[model samples]
Target chain A: MPNASEPPTTSPGIVRRFWWRSGQRTRLAVACAGVLGALAVTGAAGFSGDARLAERGGPGVAVHRGDSFEVTVRAVSGVDLFEGVEPGTGRVFGARVAGVSAAPCWQSQSLAVAENLLRGKKVRLIVKKDGDTGTDRLLVDVELPDGTDYARTVVDEGTASADVAARGELGPVESAARLQRRGLWAGGCTGYRDDALAPPSSTPQTSSTTAVPTTTTTTPPPVPTTTTEEPAPEPPPTATEEPGDDEWLARFEGKRCLLEGTRRTSPKGTEIVCTRGPRGQLRWQRAD
Target chain B: MRTEDHVDLFAEAVEADPAPTRVDGGRPRGLTAEGWVRTTGWLQVGDHPVSSVLLAAVAGLLWALVGAAALVTEFPVAAGVLTLTTPVVSGVLWWLFTTRLRPASTARNVDTCRADELEPGDTIRLHGSIGPIGQVVEVALDDDARVVLHGGARRTWARDDVVHLAELLR
Candidate 1:
């Protein structure tokens, strides 16, 4: 009989040990397969299409040369792979739509819409021209079995923007979607209209509009007061007060003016008083 | 003989028997009658199947083979995409299973003792305010229900709070 403190020679313990050893072997095999698979993919790609094209024409030439062909959509990767055209050379070329910009927030939805419309289905691809980077830019116009225009459908559903270099007449469809607040137009592209109306470069000068009126109004009062006090020995204090007042008013330049009030000054030279509060509201002053 | 004396004589005779007769002792092989009943009702592997890690490993190998075939057939982009994404997806699944969705241990012989049935020298795994893992040293069933843990630290627990009692396997 086995000692009570020692473990029993149980069948369950043997089964557990076998499973543990098998689990370790499985993990090692999976890791090795992953590495080998990655290497095989890279080696295959290097020996075929794009690498050959790159070597022939200084590393940036178009791999897929033909214009019009029938191809199937293999995969969707945001705006990059709008259509995947396989030109029978066993190489797949990713084709971006000639004019469409799917915003980041709408990318997944756009991909889903594209996949639903074209995945595993044959479609006619009309390559417009080589894009800026010499890759094929295609104009994919496919009618679904139910007669839905694929490219126009994506634009009309507000998933992709039509204002990307204007290659097709998708503006009207996009406009209608924006008005109806459908898809990404429904708060996804927040401030898109404002951003489009006022370009980034011109935004800072718009704040200067408020500064113009405040400077014009305050300059007239100081000029008259300075001239009247010019004969008095109080010219030094009045001169200092004018510059300080301008500096103080400059701090509230871009803020909204909730109220406006007359300016007041303190008797002591230490504090220059103003009726304006930090929140742009004017505190009322009693008559002297 | 009296009726009680006759019953005692029969019980002594049964205990003195050399054969391992059922119900001769208080419990056969130190197992309670309730425990024996549960053991008989244990689900066999064939009756109620569970997933094996070996099956998952085989599936992974098949997936890798498919990916390799795609690469050789000149669908390198598709194959490459799958190869890159598989590890990331697998890592996420591994994290989910290990950290968030770990299945509780189902070793019935180790986890089948009830709290009320705990005796002296019986160890238990407690889950409560003190911590998730605990071992019982001694138990008191007085008005103030308390247990003396392995560290000589005494803790009071409601009957329901003492959820698991560790099985003392011989």
Candidate 2:
């Protein structure tokens, strides 16, 4: 009979040997993970460092360009940004003009107003830290040097509408601007289109009106404090009445004009000049 | 019937019928059962799913990309906001991904095993605690209802510690 023997153990193949020997694959995986971790850390740090470097504009400048919004000025210690707010750290920060909602078409006009009023000027910022807007810009009530409300000016000029959430004075100002068909509201907001301008019935359904939030009552409460250092002058009276079929010149009043120097004679023989409005849109105004 | 004669007979039987050598102790050759299960879209590291980790990584990458772009454009406030909220956003996303993927049965598996039910040499993974796989050493269910487990170190854990008891197939 043959002698009994133990079966021969075959050696592991190259792949298995590589995988199991001293946990080589695990070490490789760990190393790869470590590299990825290092990259992520480096990327984050680089981004943060770049952001920090970009925050400041220049030393000793009173009004500086904001890193996020258009401008940044110090709050408190007489940075002259807002009134009746607690003093802050005086660090430069971005501030959003409260109570104005500038639609896309009117954004440039509102921005122009902001730049003119705020750039190289001392202003006040009443900061509200109630909730996160997902940006570093603070929600604030901005006031120009002459104590004119910045957001109110934008709304009153019809460059922007009152924010639906706005309380106090801005709502009434916006409603009055809309009623007068000022700036963007000219020719019922569809003045840019020929058909909408010819027919008065289609005026109410214009898409531009949708930007105004109708949730707030159209008639706002009377503002108690009307006394101000510089009250905005009332817009010059244009031909506001709905035009008859024969009245061609009457239709051009408060409507966007093509040329800056264009002049037309009204039925009353008064000269009307196409002049740029406060909201940056060119409209026919009575020649003073 | 003698012990020596029986040992010699067993040795002769083993030589007569030799079994084939299996490197993985006759278990499935390529991947372990757990590894095969992981391929079915339920990958996890301990209690957290691998998908959550990957999702958080992608989110972090996007956050970094946007932040870098914002910084290059000199929008420091936007970059600051993105940088500051990265960890929070990643954490929330990881939590959401893990919550969405975790199987209902696996979550309930923690309550299934107790110290009294465990026997010596039973291998288990604990929930809500970070440690290596534990091998039950002793089940001391006296006052504290703790089980002694030997993994790298011998330690006593509560009855509720065992999240899942796994049987290794060989």
Instruction: Note the chain A TM-score of all models in turn.
Output: 0.42, 0.41
lDDT of 2 by residue, A38-146 (tens): 5677667765554443353111112223312223343322111221211232234545556766554644444554555556666665554442322245566776677
Off by over 4 Å in 2: A1-90, A131-135, A191-288, B1-170
True contacts kept of each: 0.00, 0.00
lDDT of each: 0.41, 0.44
Model no. 1, DockQ: 0.01
TM agreement with the true structure for every prediction: 0.29, 0.29
CAPRI quality level assigned to candidate 1 from its DockQ score: incorrect
